[model samples]
Target: MPSFWSQKSKCLYFYFSGMMTKHKKCFIVGAALIIITNIFTVCVVKLTQDSQSFCPYGWIGFQNKCYYFSKEEGDWNSSKYNCSTQHADLTIIDNTEEMNFLRRYKCSSDHWIGLKMAKNRTGQWVDGAIFTKSFGMRGSEGCAYLSDDGAATARCYTERKWICRKKIH
Candidate 1:
């Protein structure tokens, strides 16, 4: 009724016991090797899992969101349409940290965002959230893009790169 592991361990002990009569640590060394092998196996699995990220292909992950920076240039409305096809909207800067992240990641070209000029307000995000963040924007009515400093207003028809964002669940 002995288990397979018990039988194998007994054989190992017997084999090493005969080979090394001077050292009495054959059984302990065998058990330690098994433990080390298991530890290495677990580490390999964890390393692979860490490399697999939450973001989809071609998207960059930051915090709980995934961002897609378009290489092709398109007008604000066209970019918005493209994002809609991808089940996402233009990037919406919700906080200073998010804005700074974009600033650091941005290339030389400015990218269209989800903000647009609305009557009697600084600006409005496409998500219907009230304008809370403050920045310098020009023109009474224009679409906003993520400029080098922050959000800047420009004509909606101006061709430019864009950013899309979606939450990671």
Candidate 2:
């Protein structure tokens, strides 16, 4: 029969081996959890950064463009000149949504825009797009203004608040 001391030594060795195995499993599981959590946090941060890209301060962002509405009044030509100085142009209404946005956000009832009358008595936008004839522009005045009713032509010298538009960088 084995001596008592030898049997005791075997028991201690087996106990220590089992404990070490359990400890090693626990350590590996904990490490894996930490790595997974870090990866998830990184992914969330990247997604939020992409989604939060926005326009500059004091400008409204819409469809990848920025719009600025002036509080001070200026004539159509003066307003266009002012916008050109800032590397922008008077606001051009391309659709009903843009028209509605301007009407809603305009500082006053009359706001100068980029629309004008061409030599042929036809309406044209500053960007050289021909205005659709369906809008029923009545006056021979060269400049256009946004009013409560809709866009209407006015004399180019008439002073009014203006809207400017530029592309987002």
Best by TM-score: 1
What does candidate 1's lDDT look like per residue over 13-33, in tens digits? 223433523434567877999
Distance from true location, Cα of 105 in model 1, Å: 1.1
- lDDT of each model, Cα atoms only? 0.80, 0.77
Per-residue lDDT, model 2, residue 125, is: 85
User: Which parts of model 1 have CA positions greater than 4 angstroms off?
Assistant: 1-53
lDDT of 2 at 58: 72
TM-score for each model: 0.67, 0.65
* Regions of candidate 2 where Cα sits further than 4 Å from its true position: 1-53
Model 1 score (lDDT): 0.80
Which digits, one per residue and each the tens of the lDDT, describe model 2 over residues 33-123? Answer: 8999999999999887855655556778887777888888999999999888877899888778888887888845688888898657788
Ten residues in a row with the worst lDDT in model 1? Answer: 1-10
TM-score of 1: 0.67
